[model samples]
Target chain A: MRTKYLVGFLVIMAAIAYLAWGGLGKSLVYYVLPSEYADNPQKYQGKRVRLGGLVKEGSVQFNPKTLQLKFIITDGVVEIPVEHEGTPPELFKDNQGVVVEGKFAGKVFHGDNLLIKHSESYKPPQQGAKLKPEEVRKLLEEAK
Target chain B: MGNSKRKLTDSLSSFLLLVGFLVFLIGQYLAFKAPPDVQQGYLVRILYVHVGAAWTAYLAFIVAAVYAILYLWKQNPSYDRLSAASAEIGLLFMALTLFGGMMWARPTWGVYWTWEPKLTTSAILTAFYVGYFLLRQAIEDPEFRAKAAAAAAILGVVNIPINYMSVYWWRSIHQTATFDIVNRKLHMDPSMVLPMLIDLAAINILFVAFLRMKGAIAARAAAREEIYD
Candidate 1:
């Protein structure tokens, strides 16, 4: 009985090892900075990849009716145009750090997922620094 | 003396349960009173329960795995009971984690479910433990059942590390861990951290109470079965 159990355990462990190895190989997508991706765009083209960078200022275009989003993600040195089919997340906007998952194509990344990466640190705005009217309105709405 | 000792433990367990419930109420109040996140808004409230449940689930499984190893080494029935009790509680909290995460995701991520590595590994962990319970039920002989459950628990522990590291190992949509233990700092504001920590404490207390109760009942059931045999 002990030998039987030992063999069973060995078989199960082997199966698990095989599955984990294969799964990791298939699912492991390296997170690349925009500059890194630009350096080797052809190498990553048509392969699933995650691109992390800041949304370039004045590069956000969204159409609510069509639910289309287009933005340029930049790492201060290189910018990549990203076209996504869904509405951008509520927090997604110019200058926000974001990580998008998709495949790179010719001069555009067709992203399927957009995740806004917020800063881990939270500091209140400097005292006496006036809040923009829109910012105040947004805060009031959130309070409601 | 034994009767009085049992009574004392019973009262102690009940007291713990009451305190846990009260603390949970306080946690709820703090959760609501805390300032909303700048981005997530009121949705941030879910983090209290979600993170608490996830942490408890991880704790439960680790405890179960340790008890399983002890049972296998010493062949102690008490260790088997402890393992099963912990696994059951772990399963309950894992379910909470999944549902709470889904609810949080819908509004925040625009989807209820995605094939992200963290989400996928969590689902796998839940399914593995569910299989553990089912495997335990399928066996007829108590010794064989305990042995099989122990083996399963030991094997299933592998998923815990995989689930924990999935966010780092793979490019996942889910955010990374909230507490950076290495840095010894939290990733959120102190105001938000306080309520989450309180909730975690309350849940942990509740876990101990539930484990004690469940372990006692399992011991009784095993005893009765032996008498019938």
Candidate 2:
């Protein structure tokens, strides 16, 4: 009886190991750089892929009414046009590292999800950029 | 002698527990008072607790692995109990880290969880410990159980460094280490450092306190079991 139970335990553990590794095998590369996709655009043409790069300067256009955001993501060598339908994260800005998950619609990448890839370094807002007490209160009031 | 030693440990653990909680409150105050991040604003505060819990979990797993090695070498039941206690606390802290991380991720990464390398490795690390407990539950014989558990504990520790280094080694959504120990450099700003350090100290002290208390309880249970046997 003990041997039987031990066998059952081993079998269950083996099954779990298989499933965990099998799932991980597919998503090993979390996101691909724009340059990487440019290298083999054929592979990711129809399939959904996470395109990651820095948001291009002076390319961001957001329509608050329609909730549509369009921007260009570039890796200095390759640039991909992105069309996302949602509010971007507060950290989202020009030259900011971003990952857009979606499929390509012809030339544009229609993003279903947008994420900010922030750096490890953090600093306080510069001296003049610091929010005044009155402005903080006004912002709080607006939030309310 | 044993009774005196037990009393000493009891007081020591209690002292640590008291200090840990007090310092945690102080850490929270400092974290809030610290200037908001240039990018993340208030969201950056979540990392103070998250990183602290993560580091404590790593420390606990390392301690468990060390105790497991000691238990195997000396064949000591006390060492096994201590190892088990440390692993248990480590698992609890790892859970906290995961929960806090998810909360941080939702706002920052736009997803609660992803199959990124750091998150995936952390999930694997947690699974190993869960398996450790399950293996412990399955074994009936005390000697066999301790031996198997010790081996598992030691083996499970192999994932710690891998999990910590996953962000650097692979393409990850998660940021790299704030405290880059390998290069002996702190990546974060000066103002942000003190509060995070305080949080780290608070969590580690609490881990030690909890381990001591849990170890004592396990020792008592073992003693009671011996009497019944």
- Number of the top-ranking candidate, with TM-score as the measure: 2
DockQ, Cα level, model 1: 0.21
| TM-score of predicted chain B versus true chain B for each candidate | 0.94, 0.95
Sequence-dependent TM-score of model 1? 0.82
Residue-level lDDT tens digits of model 2 in B1-229: 3654555367889999999999999999999999998888889999899999999999999999999999999999999999999999999999999999999999888889887788878887887787777777778798898999999999988889988888777888899998987667788889999999999999999998999999999998888788789
User: Model 1, residue A66: displacement in angstroms?
Assistant: 3.2
Q: Rate the local accuracy (lDDT) of all candidates.
A: 0.81, 0.88
Local accuracy of candidate 1 as per-residue lDDT tens digits, B46-164 = 88899899999999999999999999999999999999999999999999999999998877766687656787677668867876776776677789999999999888888988888
Among all windows of 10 consecutive residues in model 2 chain B, the one with the lowest summed lDDT is B1-10
lDDT of 2: 0.88
Quote the positional error of residue B129 for candidate 1 in Å: 1.4
